[model samples]
Structure formats: structure tokens, C-alpha cells
Target chain A: MAAKKLNIKDKYRLLTRDLDWDFSYEDPKKAFPYEEFEGIKITDWNKWEDPFRLTMDSYWKYQAEKEKKLYAILDAFSQNNGHLNVVDPRYVNAVKIFLTGVSPLEYQAYQGFAHVGRQFSGVGARVACQMQSLDELRHVQTQIHAMSHYNKFFDGFQEFSHMHDRVWYLSVPRSFFTDARSAGPFEFMIAIGFSFEYVLTNLLFVPFMSGAAHNGDMATVTFGFSAQSDEARHMTLGLEVIKFLLEQHEDNVPIVQKWIDKWFWRGTRLLTIVAMMMDYMLPNKVMSWKEAWEVYFEEAGGALFKDLARYGITMPKYADVIEKEKEHISHQAWWTFYTHGHAAGFHTWIPSDQELDWLSEKYPDTFDKYYRPMWELAKEQEAKGERFYTSGLPQLCQTCQIPMLFTEMDNPNQNSMRDTVFDGERYHFCSDGCCDIFKDEPEKYVQAWLPVHQIFQGNCGGPDVGDILSDYYRMNVGVDNMDIKDSPDEQRWNKWKGVA
Target chain B: MSKVYIALQDNDESRYIVEAIEESNPDATVIHMPAMIRIEQENRLVIERKVVEEKMGRDWDVQELHINLITLGGNVDEDDDQFVLEWKQ
Candidate 1:
């Protein structure tokens, strides 16, 4: 007779428990030095329960199957000229920005998880970190594989890793990841796993994937689907870590709270790119950033934070400030991108009348009042055959690294600017939220790799924007980035459709 | 009562979840849109772990529903084994 099944529940329990052994050879504290520095007190490993009873065997079995299905579809999509079915060249800009900025962060997360997976004292936490490490690596491969398929028919997909390292705008994502990675293991979990994955993941990820679907990008939709279950697990690990830390010691509440506040603000700032992608970059729309913010964050996140209030943790301090910025940040970010996008990878275009009307309808309070006129002016200049890009680099915030493009929350016309002197030098911030964060850890942030500052210091490919684009950014000028009228993707798109 | 509803992104991961939703809530009407899939039921929609597990041939947790979840309506009533959406919490 065949052996009885090692049923899922019992198997997970045994597998997780079997790893525990008496550490007579070395003191556990001496063995794991990184666990105690963050001041988190964990009394019992049993307090950490993995909501998903995943084990090694099942993990392997499930992941193997996903890769199989993913590659099969990727092959079919590539062979059939999937690029032709894509909605428009404008939509592919979303894909380009995603590939250039976000895909590398996946690789960064892979490294972060590897460190924590090794350093955590609790087996449950270690196992979760290990799985997350694997998940991040999986995301790295999957996103690049999907993006590489587009490279066959598109520009700007090359040199993504190099671009992420040196480009001016790429610093937003670079700093967001490295800040989390440089912290102690527990703080890293809070910074990324909880605040990033649990609180902010929906806002950044959902719209891009949905926008991909709307635009006939099947590979991107598949990338989103393939990672969904793993993302659910990552979020659970984050939530569970907070609960475990809180339950272990009363003092841990505030430390975790502070991390939540810092990371939430950081997460919001990092998502400025995603906000721009959703609202402006995608050719076919999903929903406005305002609506996505309302549905994904305001409603869902309200419930989540309320659930956590039982632990004596309230919401992040500047939560209301985020609500105010939502109506304005996407438009503000797009304008900056519109002017500087040529120096970067993708082309930026003036919104057609219909698109401008949609922006006005969606952003009724702010668009016409502030942004529509600017686009109208850009169009007017273009009508007379004048093209545009930022003549000089704008001032970047010390903490968030975003240029001082965001407007005052109450007064939409004025740039929401703040600055403070650390040591002897004055540092600029985009808003009160960023200024507050800078004051919290002035030293950690003063060391920030501000791209604009680096450029002026003559570290970036000399003084000329031409040298900066080609020598520094690898931009192919008119072919890689320009108006949608004569850009390479648009030309390819026209040629493909011209056949029909 | 208004229709009990949920929407998930359109992708391979959701196929099993959508199948499980259809299995548990027989009257569920699945609507396919660009990059998103929506489902509606008469007065209730149930997501059963047993059904999802059966579809994937592995264990599933109700929390896993969040991975594919775009938006869900009605009040959510959830437990370790199953999650149900109905008019009242």
C-alpha cells in the first residue's frame, strides 16, 4: 500500500519545528549579532505563526509550476508579435519606466531578503525571509524576462541596470531600497515588508498591471498574476512581524510606530513615479491616481490601520498631508518628467484634447486651475515648432530626492518648499513631510546621492546635456526619446499598423 | 440588496481564484475587462479554501485572496478556512 499523505498542516509544523536544535556550541546572541541592535524583544518563537502553512516541498512544487506556465506564455507571446497587439507607443512608456526604475529594485529586494534571512533569530521569521528572498529573485527574473521581450521591438529597454545606477531620476528608487537594506533586520522588515508591502504595495503595483492589461500587454499581466500569491505572503510576513514585535514587549510599540511613520512617508514619496505612470504615461487608462488612492489606500488602508490601532499604534503623523498631495502630485510629477524626459529614457507628449479633458474631469479641483494652462503653453510652443526640455536641473529634496516640483498643499500655485541647516549647509525639501523626515535622521540623509548635485559637482559626464544623455544616460536622442511624432516606437507602431 | 461583488486583476494567478469563486458562489457572473476581471453574485459571494485548494492542488489560506484582489464590495466575513462577502459584517 502507498504511504499515507504527510498532510499539509502536520507537515508544515514538523518541518518548521525540526530545524530547532540546542545551540550548545555557541551562545545564540553571539551567533546572531544583528537581531538585538534594533531594540526589538522577542520572548518566544511560538508567538510567530505563519498564516500560510507553506513548507519547503510545497513551495518548490508551486513555484516550479508557475515558472512553467509563465515561460510557456512568454514564448507564445513573443513568437506572435505581441508588440503589435499593444495599445499605443504612449502606453509602452509606462512599461519602459517600469523596466528602467522598478525592475532593478526587485533585484535590490532580493539582496535585502538574503541578508535578513541569514540574520533573523526566529526560525519562522528566517523562513519567511528566506521565502521572500526567493520571491524577490523570482520577481527580478520575471520582470526582466517580460521587459526583454519588449526590447526586441523597442528602444530604452537596454542598459537598465547601468541606467538605474547613474541616471538622475533613478535615485528615487535606489535610495528607497538602500535605506531599508542598510537598517537592522527588524527595522528592514518594518521599512519594506510591512510599510512597503502591506501598506503601499497595492497603490504602486495594481494600476501598472491593470494598465498593462488594458493596453494588451499580456506578459506584464502575467508578471502581475505570477507574483500575486507571493506578494500576499510578503504582506502577511510584514503584518505578522509587527504583531510579534508588539506582543513581545510593550516598549517595542513606539519603535515600530516610528519605523511605520518613516517608511510610510518614504513609500509615498517613492510612489511618485508610479503615480505619474498611472495618470499620464499609460496610453489607455485604468483609473485616475486620485481614484486609485481613494480605493486602494483610503478605504483598504483605513481598515488596516484601524485594525492595528488595537496595539496602541495610530496612523502615520502626516497622513492627511498625503491625502492633500494626491490631487496634485501626479500632475506635478508628469510636468517634471515632460520637461526632463528627453534627458531620461522615454518621450513625453502634450495631452490631446480628449486626454486633457479627461485630466480636467478627473482632477476637477486642480487640473484646469493649475496644470492645463501649462500644457496649453507647451502645445502653443510646439505649434510654432519649438521643442522643450528643462534648461537646467531643478533643486532636489534632501530626503525624498524628488525635485522641488510638488506644490504647496493649501496653496496650489506655490511650490511647497522647506529647508533646514544641518551642520552648516542648508538642505532643501519638497514639503513639510519631507522636512520632518530629514530632521529625524539628518546624518543618514545628508549622505544621500542627489543626482543633480553630483551633476553640478562635475561627476556626471561633463557639463553638457548632450554628453550627459549619451555618455552618462545612454540615451539614443531622437530614437530613444523625443516627441511621439517621430520616435522609434511610434514609427514601428505606424509601420506595423500601416500594413493593415 | 445590491449585488455582492469583487474584482481581481486579469491574469493566470486569478484563474484559480476566479474558478474557486465560481465553484463556491454558483451564480457568480464573471466579467472580463481590459487587464481586470470582475465578478458579481446575487446576495452573497463565497471564497472557499477547499475549492481553491482543489483547483491548485495545494493548500490555500483565505488571506491569499488579497494577492489577486483589486476591489471587493459588501461586508467581508472571514475565517481561517473560508472567506465570505455578504451584506452585513
Candidate 2:
């Protein structure tokens, strides 16, 4: 059967215009909120044009191709003994954190995208959202499949579902996403879609891809880059939606600006985990967190905000806070990872001499001052064939779930701490932002999915690290096959570098 | 010289793509508006239909242009004669 040729204009009219229905029971202004936000007058919603020019068939075809390519990489990685070649077993900890922390969020994005596909009035948008929905699902599945290989050698791999519910660290991401989901559709677009996708995801995806590629994890590198190609489309959606809202009204400037301010900070805070993983967790670090921040945020963010300034939005309120924290967020998160390695899905071993030298070169300031001392302590223990552990629970922030190492605003030395008592129980927070979130709804905060609590509950499928590995490495996990530590790629990498 | 219009939903990546295209194709004049981008010049403006199809992994008709347009800042009206791109000043 011959496929019927589809017209672009008709597709546009059918998607955006034809799908919308007037609500007889409620005013359209109240339903849409386009008019009440500010002084913007949409003389015509039809004037909006989605520049990427996507259709349903094209969306599926490209998406399927992306998935096919990603799955092939996963297959090759596992079939070829990928795990043995890892720089160290400890590096698997980073991959585990990624699988547990991020992979599930991809599934959430898939669900959200489905909602967007249905709610968005435009056919083109609906199609695009459908593609994104599928893309997010693919990301979740592929990530789980790729990391499932290390389930044999890692700890903390089994209880992610429970961990996310009870772990203080997860509160950062959980709260951030919950905030977005609770808002009206437009606010969701601005918070998760535009602000995060456009402003921050590249900072994360690019470095992750580069690090995976550099360290000889071919499957991870390929998947990261492939997934990012779709992210470019989302970034465009974010940008277009913001502008569309802005052009729709003059008063939207402030409302939009508030969202940018709120989301940018929220997104930046959640990414401290990424920054640490990129800068400190990788066995072969690419760039310092400070450098990534300067390039991705200071340069790119500075330029972007400057452009938006012409539209009357100022730089976010907490821009300076981010600027100052860039120097230390990596150090703080890595310290937490190191201290909590025994409880984590991955291991944390002391860096080799070569790795130490590399760190000295990458991080001139704190690498020697703060990290070197800790490494020296770990090295002393390693000589005795022992590894370090904190032996107690970390004092987690009531809000962000991060340890209270983040310094006070503009005071890098004084640890930022806020305390509040509810029913005579003291609650600690790293920053007021998180405290405010907790204060707004203590009940929600109390129910956070914390990874630590799950371990105590014995719900992680095992009583010990060895047993947990077996359960988490089940067939459904997909990553059960490839071992990056001993893989051919890692062997080849070691041989090429003359590093045994 | 005739003009080419490009529209971008204002953000970093679309802006980066516009800049990248401009960097690669210097002769093509590019203009940015609040919503999309416009690229215009007479020098054989082609989307490399074969490459696009290969990347997408399927056949696509020329009329499905609006569906693929993720960002549109201005008007790119392709009629019987010339392709027209315009923005409100």
C-alpha cells in the first residue's frame, strides 16, 4: 500500500488548532491561564511555529533507530567480557549511583511525556512529546541494561526503589520533580522542559558521554550520546515554549523570570551529584567540576541570560550562590561518596599514584589541600590491606539529603546549616531553600525514598554486599552480562597505555 | 540576494545550532527572532534530503516540513516560485 503524502500546513492546523476544544463550563482564560499571568495578548495561537518540523512517522523511525543502535552496543559490551577491564571495581560505584539515581527518572519523564502528548493542543507537539516519551523509556531501559552488568561486584544495587523513598540524598531530586509535577502544565514546561533541558542537561550529558568514552566504556558512551541527540529536541522545546509564553504577554516576563530563578537553582542543586560523579567519581576524570561549571554555566549560562535580558528577564537570584559553590560542590559530593562507599552499590578505592598525579593536575586548589590528605589516610589503610569506613550514619540535610558540607552563602568555610524543630524533633538542612520546601510540607519530606534506610530495613534483597549483587544482577536488570573492569575494551585501554 | 528565514524557540542549543550553521556556511545570512531562526541566501540551500532520510530511517515528503519543525521564529512560505521568510519588525 502506498503511504499518503502529508502536508505540513495541514499537519500543523490539525495538531494545534483542530485538537483544542472550547470549555463551555469554564472561561478559556481560567483554563489556560494565558491571560491572567500578565499583560500578554495572544491575538493568534496559530502564529506559533515549532521549528524542528517533526511528524509522527519521522519521530518513530528515528527513535527506533536510536534504540537499535543503543541495544547493539549493550549486547556487544556484555558478550565480550566488559567488566574485568574497569579501572577499578570501585569505579562501578559511580555507575551504580547513575543507574539508581537517574535511570528511574527517565521512566518518570516517559510518563510525563505521555501526559504532554495528550494535553498539548498542537499535533506537532503531541507527536514530539510522543517521541520524547518513547525516548525516555528507552533511556530508562537501556541505562538499566547497561549498568546491570556490575550487579555482581557492587553493593547498594538492589534497593533503589526503596532507597529513593527513604534515602535523604534522594530528597533533592524527588522534591525537585514533585515541585514540577504539582504545577500547572505551563509551569511544568518552564521548570523541567525549558530551564532544565536547555540550561543544564547538556552540562551533564556531554561530560558524561566524554568521560564514558575516555574510560573505555563504549556501551555507556554510545548510549549517552545517542540519548542526547533527542535531548537537543527537548532543549528546543524548552526554548520555544519560553519564548512563546513571553511573546504571548508582556507580564509573563516576571512570572517566567521567577520560574527560571526557581528551577535554575533547583536543577543546579540536584546536579551536585553529577558534578561529583564527573569530577571525582570517574576513574579517569576528564575535567574538574569547576571547569565544567565555567564552560557550561558561566559562559553558556551567562550568554543565555544576557540574551534573555533583552526580553526583560534578569539573571536568576541565586546566580552568585551557584558561582561560589562551583568551586566546592564536587569536592563535597565526592567526600560523601568516599565515606559511604561500603553502603553503596559500587566500591571506593584509593587512587593509584598515576591517578593522584592526574588529580593534582586537574584540581590545583582543593585536590592537594582537602582531598590529598583524605587519600593519604586511605593509602595508609590500603597498605595494610584495609579500606576506610565512617562507621556511622551521615548527618543528612532535612531538605537536599546531602551532608551538611555545603558552606554558608558567600562563606565557603562556615558550613551552611539551618535547624528547625517539629514536634520537638530537630531537623537539619543545608540551605534555606530546602528548609522552605520541608516547611511547606513536612509530611512529604518525611516520606523521602532514602537509600540508607532501605539497607537497615533489609529490603535490598540481601544481608551483605555479596548477596545483594546476585539479586540486583537478575536478567531483567539487563546489565548482568558486561563487566567493564575486565572487558576487552579496558584490557585494550590498559595495553595501549602500558598500564597492566 | 534572496533571504532565508529561521525560527528558534529561544534557548541555548537552537541558538548554538544557528551559530554553528552560520559558522559553517558564512555566505548564508542568518537572522534570529523571539521564536525561531531565519537563514537566507541564494547559494543552493539544500537540506540534504538523502542524509536527513538516512538519519531519520524513513522516507519523508517535502510537505511534512511543519511536523519536523521543532522551532519556528518567523515565516518560511514556500510557494510556486520562491521561498519567502519574514519577521515583524
Candidate 3:
């Protein structure tokens, strides 16, 4: 009789588990040094189940196929002048923000996963992280390639990597990743692999990808599809990691819970940018930020937490606050960028009358009452040739690094600011959640590279915002940082489309 | 009985999987939204590897369903043959 063929499970075990060597000369503890530092107990590495039965050979084969398909679409898009096919010139600002603000996070994810991939004792986890690290690298590359065509025409697409490191608002995302990467391997898994990839990834990818499709951005939409295929493996790894840790020992439950709370709050704060993009940036909107939050977070996350409850895990702390903030953050974040348009890397403008009405309809209880009046005042100022730009810099939350733009959830007019002293220095936060996160680790947050603080300390090039914008952040001043109404971007678009 | 659901991106790849699912679980309700397709069933939902392979006219690995999976609810029991989702009592 012929020998039985090896199944996928057997092949995966051989490729992953069988590759691990028994430590003889060196201690395993010294090898995987970061494993136990985060208070997570992993009693047995053998209990770690491989989430996806994929060998390195199959992974390369699949990714190569995806890259082939993605590059073909990107080529077609460039050859066909896909930039002109968008719904409106304003739509490109969303892509600008994405390329600058979000793509760099993919690179950070790659570095993070690669680092943790080396630190985990479980071969299954190491293989999983190694695969996700590659996935993130591919995502960033494809994202850059997809947007490179737009860079030929758009103003703000340049200097994204430089701006990611030095810009004021870009620090919000940068610090989030740096914080995760700085943690021990177990916390890194919970912070990124589980909390971010499993719980919050849909909120990030689905809206942006769907927004791309709705707005006729073929290159971006194609890349979104390509990256999403890899997201499944990442997400399954996230789920598996959490389950393995939770089931290993009862003590790990609280540690994992605290991480879920911390990362969940941080993830929501980072997604405020996404909320603004969905509500204001996309000319052909996919859905209101509030609606997307409901579908993605409230309903879907609710179901996930229900399953997690069996392991003594409840819904994340402050989920109610996040629910309320969904109704408010998008409006508030847009207003912040609008007032500070001169400092922002992307163009900002008062929403059209139709958009204001849409906001009122979607946010029936709050928009007309609180937000519409503010837009009306801005419109009045613009009509009077006194287009509003706040000269003074706003205070930023030490934890989230977002300018303290968010309002009190209960009172839309009241700022939800909190402050506490650590080591004889006063630290401020935007909300109770942020304040708590800071207090939990004051030493880590006190070292935050706050842009506003750096500028005030004579560290960011010069005194004037324009000097810093151009010299330090590499923004092109008037060309890159202003309203879309009369900027070079708009003018060029009009000239190309013959809108005389 | 509580409902279990799985959402997949609305694309050509998922259409075959969705067809196989609908045929297998006759009581499942399929809802199509913008850029996404959701299938929900009370108590349990199953996706058989053989059925999807038959529908696609090619060999299909159970793990390939995740290529388009957006999100899912309930406890999951997956293997080489089939993927099952249900609420644990």
C-alpha cells in the first residue's frame, strides 16, 4: 500500500513545531527573556495551537498571487489616470491623511510583530507573529504604491514619513505604536495582536476600504482588498493568543483584562481620526461615523465580549463613554483641524450646506443644538474675509497625544479635561480614561514627545508656526497647509477638469 | 435561541462561499449591505469544506473562508472538514 499523504495539519506541525530545538547549552528563559516579565503565565508552550495551518512556502505563494493581482490593478489605475476619476477633489484629502497618518502605523506594526516574534517561546506564536510581520510590511508597501500615483498630482502626499515623526497630530498614532512596542511580549500581543487586530481592526479597514470603493478610488480599493486577505490570519492569531493566555492560568485573566481596557481606550482615541475622515473627508461618504461605530463596535464587539465572558472577561472598561463619544468625536476633531488648518498637513474647510444637514440628521440630538451653530459662525467669518485660524496651540493629552479637542460626553459644551501631578510636574489628560491610563504608568507617559511642548521649549526649529511647519515638519506652507476652497490643490484640479 | 452570524466582504470570492452556506443552512438569512454580505442563523451556522469546493469547482481549504471574513459572533469549532459557529449554553 502507498504511504498516506500528510494533511495540512501534519505539514504545518512539521514546518513550525518540529523546527524548535531542545535547549541544552543555553536556558530557554535566557533565550525568550521577555516572555514572563509582563506577569502572564504560560505553563505549556505545547498547548499553543497554530491558528492558521499555513507553511512558509504556502504563505509566500499566496502573498505572491495577491501582489500580482494588486500590482496589475495599480498599473491599470495609473495608466488610466485614476486620480481624475474620484468623486471630488476633497476625496483626495482622505487619501492624503491615510498615506501620511495611517500607513506609517503599518510599518510600526511590522517592527512590533517582528520583535515579539523573536521573544515568544512558543514556536506556533513565533511563526504566527513572523507571518503577521511580513503581512504588515506588505500592507505598508502596497499602500505607498497605491498612493504614489496621487502623489504626482496632490500636494500633501510628499514628506509623509518625515511628517509622521515630527508633526503635532501624527504623534498620536506614532506614540500609540511606540507604547505597544516598548511593552513586554505578552502585553504586546494583548495590546496589538488581540485588542487591535481582533477587536478594532474592522473599524479601521472596512470604512476606509469601503470609502475607497464608494469614491471611485480603484487603486486604494484594490489595495484594501489585498491587505484584507492577510488580516484574516492576523485576526485568527489574535484570537488564538488571547485564548491561549487566558486558558493557561487564572492569574492571566486580570492582566489580559487590564490590557484590553488600556488598548481598547487607546484604539478608540486613535480612531477619532478615522471618524473625522468618514464624516467629513469622504465626499461620497460610505456611512456616518456613528452608524459605523454601531455596526462595528456596539453590535459586533458586543457579541465578541459575550463569548469572552466565559473566560471571566467582561466588556472593556469605559465602553459606555466610547459609545457616547462616537456621537461627538468626529465633529469635535474636524473642528480642531478646521481652526488649526494652517498647521495641519491636509486641507480643511467648512463642510458644505448639504453636509451640515447630513450631520444634523445623523446626530439629531446634538448637531443642530451644538455643532451647527459653530459651523454657521465659521461660515460667517469666511464670508467676511476673516477665515478663522486659531493662532494659539491647543493643549494635548499626555496619554493619547490628541489635542484636548474632545468635549464632555454629558455636556457637549464642556471640555472633558483632567489633570494630575506626577513627580512634582502637572500632567493633563483629555478625559477620565486618558487620565487613568496616564496614572497607571506615569513614568512612561511623562516621557511623551509632545509637539506643543517641544515647540514651546525652542526645540522645534523656530517660534513661528509656519517656520516649524515648513522647516521641521517639511510641509510646503501655503501649498500643503490651508483650506481646500482656494488652495493650489483645488486650483490645479479645476484647471485639469476645465472648470472655467 | 440566540443568533450566530458571519460577515464576509461582498466580492466574487465570497459569493461562492455564501452560495454554499445558503444551500447547506436553509434557515439562514442572508442580508446584503453596501460592500458587505452578512449571513445569520439562529442557534448554529455551518460551512462545509466539501460544499464550498463543489460550488467553486476547485479544492477549498476551510481556512480560505477567512480571506473574506469581516467578523463573526459566537463560539467557533473549526476543522479540516467543516467550520461551525454556535452559542455555548
Candidate 4:
């Protein structure tokens, strides 16, 4: 006999809502004592609602379908020798950045969401977090699988697990996720869900995916589009948590706003790599990094804060810094890579004449004024057989752990440097934003895994660049790094174009 | 102001919706965002389910838009077939 079918809302109410208990043995607060540490007061947990109303049955079904679709694309592409059909060899830099900097972060997210799922008091929050945990694990697996095809032929991708932990540029992402994973459940949600996923995910994904699509990387584009589809649900969870907190109690507003301020800046700083990837990395441009900020961050974020003003919340405090820095960030990041990319896995080159013209066209206000002359000089140096590559390790930011490469806001010649001394040990930051983060939590920032500092302290392999590059970084400079013209990738691609 | 606006939380579902809106309303300006997409068009913005289905490459119900719908400005004239946003005379 067939039993009566139930609608999705009823199923969610039964599976998620019906599972909550009014503990008979002890106080509910005592059972979920971890919730009280963050000082967020939730008057009633019933106020929370899953926007998608998904039950476990639907969740498994949906995920299995997506997984099937993903593997099919990967299998077919593998049979076709998809790596050879790429638009340019340089586009693989974007993929390298993703594998090295972004993939391990997904694994971190998996751990984070799993902990939050078990720790949070609310059934709804727990279920959403649990689902997201599974999603993140799927993301990491799928990403590794998608890029594994390239790994068979590529040089730099062979050592992502090692590089993410010990490399200089990669520490920016590693520490960012580590900080979130170690925080309390509520703070983790606000830090990752509300601030990172909800506030600034577009800037991270759009340029990379767009570059993949235009660069003839069908596998990467497929992976990115699939992951981006999941991000919408993650974003909803972010928005829902903030609203649930605000609606539960008025006191939760100020605490939530502080987290928003703190994480917004932190997330923005981590994106400096992406800014360079968008402007200097892509062979075919979708939009400049500056244009992406205006389209994605400013316009969309402005409307959101206006909506949230009803809860007496304000926009991020350091938004002006973001606006002012956008014009210079891509240029600064590219220059840093051009000089110091040998320490890392990816390569860098001076922009071609057409590429430099595109930069000026996209960044008319500042590129010509401040950044172009540096590239022009590099071009002349290349002509004279004097291409510059820095052998000195960069001074690391105590908070973000990136190099101290940002320039002074007004003075082009001076570096934008800030520092503070805690417990007789001096700490340096690249900008006031990073300094503020350090000042708030000296103990936390003090323990950062700064790569350059570790290198100096004889922690990462050894002091010698040769030992460090091969033994520690697992990279061969001439193979992993390139000058475009003399690269094996270029030579291999030339055969297909009949230019060989 | 002779403008109508529609806002949907930026997600996979709404990517198709935004693409559909752009196709139907050529004058509509989409504001890309971190968690949402907002579209503003002069006087009226039409959302055709046909365009959304084509963009998504699947069968899509017009009502599915509400799952990721955040907030919209202008009178929402919604039905099973389509959703139209415009100001009254």
C-alpha cells in the first residue's frame, strides 16, 4: 500500500523542527554552553528558518546529481587531452593560484562547518551548517579532480598541499581560514558565512572563472560554475544568520556589526592576489579588477547595507580604504609578483604592449600617472639584458602575512608601512587596516605563521634560496616560473598554432 | 523617478534569473553584488519564465524565483506565468 506523500515544508518541519528537545535532565543552556561565550543572545531558536526548506532526502539527491554531472565532464575532457587546447599557457597561473591558495582553504571550511554543525544550539543552524560542511568537502574533492588533469602536464601544481602551508604568498589564505576555524561557532558563522561568503565572494570567483572560460579551460570553467551554483545557497545561509540574530534580540546588532567590520577588511586584504590575477594574469580580459569592484562590491554592497540600516547597522568602516586602494592594488600586486614571483610557484612577466595599453584604458586615472613608468623601465631593462628578480626575502605583514609591498597612499616612493611592539617583539603591517587587526588581538596576530619570518628563523627547510626553492617549495624556477617567450608551454602551444 | 527595480539574492538560481532579465529587458542595468543582484529599468521590468528556462537549460517554474528573492521596489505583479514590476499610474 502507498502511504500519503508529504510536501517539502512539512518534511522540513518534521525532520528539522521536530528533532529539537526540551532536555529533561538538565538546563538547555548548560547543554549548549558554547553558545554563551560569544555574547550573542538568542531569545528563541524557533525564529530561524531554512530558506531552501531542504530535507536530507532532497539534499542527497541534489548533490548526487551534481556530482554525476561534474565527473562526466571531467572524464570526457580527460579523454580529449583538454590541457593542450588552452587559450594561453599563462592562464594556468590562475589555476595554480586556486590549487595552492584556495583548495586547502576549502578543506579548512569543511572542518569549520562540521564543528559548527555539531556545536551550534539551533537545529536549523546545525542542519544548514552540516549541509554546507558536506558541500565544502565536495568542493575540495571536485576542485582537486578538475585540476588534476592539468597536474599531469603542469609543473607548479604537483606541490599544492606543501605550498599552501609553507609558501609566502599562500600564508595569506591559510591564516585567514585558520583564524575562522579556531573561533567560536557564532563568530565563525559571522566571519565566514556573513562576511566572506556573503560580503565578497563575487570578487574571488568571477574573474577566475571568466579567465578560465576565455582561456579555453573547459574543465576549470565547469568546476567554477558548479561551485558558484552552490555559493548561492551558502550566501543565503549568511544573510539568514545575520537577520536571525538581529530579529532575535536588539543587542546582537552591535556585536554582529563589529564582526562585519573586522572580517570585511580581512577578506579584502586576502583578495590582493586576485586583483593581480584579474589584471595581469588573464590572457583574455573580462574586466579589470577596478571595474569588478565597482560592479560587484560597491553597487551590490551599498544596496545591502541600506537594507540592513533598519537594524541600525552601518557599512564597513574601512570601505574608503578599499575604494582608494583599488586603483593602485592591481598595479602594486603585479609589480610585487614581477619582482618576487621566483619564491612562489607561479610565474610573472611584463605586460605586452597591447596588455599595457589595456591596463591604461581600464585604469586611465592612475595607471599612466604612477604604475606605467615602472613597467616601461622594466621593458627597457629587458631590452638591455637586465631583467630584475629580487633574491631577498620580503618583510612580512604580522597580521596578513603577505609581503610589505604596498606603497604609501600619497607618496609613491615610500612604502606603506605600520608596526606595533607587543611584549618587546616588534610587529609590522602593510597598511593601517592590518595594524588595526593586530592592535585588537596582539596574542592572536603574534602567533601568525609568517613565511619570511619562519625562513629567517630557520624553520622552513633552510636559509639558502636553492635549498628552499627545491627542498621546501618543491619548485624548479625555470620550469615553474616563466618569461613567456622561452617557456616550454609556449613552445608546445606553438606547435598547435603552426608557429613552431 | 520613472524606474522599477528587482533584487534577488545572488546565487546560482538568480544567475539564470539575472541573465533572463538582461535578455528581456535590454535597458535594465544589473548591479552585480557579493550576495545579490539588483536590476533597475525605466518604468517597467518584465521577467519571462521562457528566457529563464533557456538560460538555465532546464524546466523552471516562475515561482522558484522567490527562494532567492531578497527585496524589490515597484508593485509586484506576479502570476504563475510571469512576474512584472512597474509603478501605478
Q: Which candidate is the best by TM-score?
A: 3
Tens digits of per-residue lDDT for model 1, A1-500: 99887655567677677776768888998888998888888788876777666787667777777778778888988999887788777888888888889889989989999999989877878888998999899988998998898898888888888899888899999988998998899999999888888757767666667777788888888887667547756776787788789889998999999999899998999998888888887777878999888866776566567667778988887999999889988888888888876776887888888888999999999899999999988988888888667688889999889888988787889998899999999999987878888898898898999998898888887778778888888878777777677777887788878932
Superior candidate under DockQ, 1 versus 3: 3
The lDDT per prediction is: 0.81, 0.62, 0.88, 0.80
Candidate 1 local Cα displacement, residue B68, angstroms: 7.0
List, residue by residue over A1-500, the lDDT tens digit for candidate 3: 99997777887889777898889999988998888878888899888886457788778877887788789889999999999999899889988888988899999999999999999888888898999999999999999999999999989998999999999999999999999999998898899988888767777777667888888898887787678778767776887888899999999999999999999999999999999999998887778999989877887677777778889999999999998888898999999999999999999999999999899999998899889998999999999999999978889999999999888887889988999998999999998999999999998999999999999999999878889999999999999988998899999999999996
Ranking by TM-score: 3, 1, 4, 2
Candidate 2 regions off by >4 Å?
A1-10, A19-44, A84-87, A116-127, A152-162, A380-387, A409-411, A419-427, A432-500, B1-23, B26-89
Every candidate's CA RMSD: 3.8, 8.1, 1.8, 4.7
DockQ, per-model, please? 0.22, 0.07, 0.39, 0.12
Give the lowest summed-lDDT range of ten residues in model 1 chain A. A299-308
Q: Can you list the residue pairs that collide in candidate 1?
A: none
Question: In angstroms, how far off is B69's CA in candidate 2?
Answer: 15
CA shift at A467, candidate 3, in angstroms?
0.6
Which scores higher on TM-score, 2 or 3? 3
lDDT of 2 by residue, A1-500 (tens): 89875555556556666766667898665554433343434455565666556556566776776677668867888888676666654465567667767777787778777775666544545666677788788887877777776554444466665555434455567666766766556677788788788768867776665666667676666566666667766776776677777877787788788778777877888899998788766777766677768756775556556556657878887688788777678767766666665444444445668877877787776578656777888778756866566675666676566667787655555788898877677788787766765776687667655444555677766675445444532322213223234444345446755786
* Segments of candidate 1 deviating more than 4 angstroms: A1-3, B1-33, B38-46, B49-89
Native contacts recovered by candidate 2, as a share?
A: 0.00
Tens digits of per-residue lDDT for model 4 on A1-500? 89878765677888777988778988877877778888999888888887567678877866676678678989988999998878778888788889999988889999999998988888999999999999899889999999999888767898899888877788899999999888888889988988888757767765567567777888887677667656766776887888789988998998998889889988888888889888988888878899888866786566567667778889998898788888898899889888875665876788888999999999988899999999989888888997877768888888888788887767756889998999998899998888988898898878898887788888877658878888887777677865655666567667767884
- For each candidate, how many residue pairs have backbone atoms clashing (under 3 Å)? 0, 68, 0, 2
Candidate 4 interface RMS: 8.5
- Chain A, model 3: TM: 0.98
Candidate 4 TM-score to native: 0.88
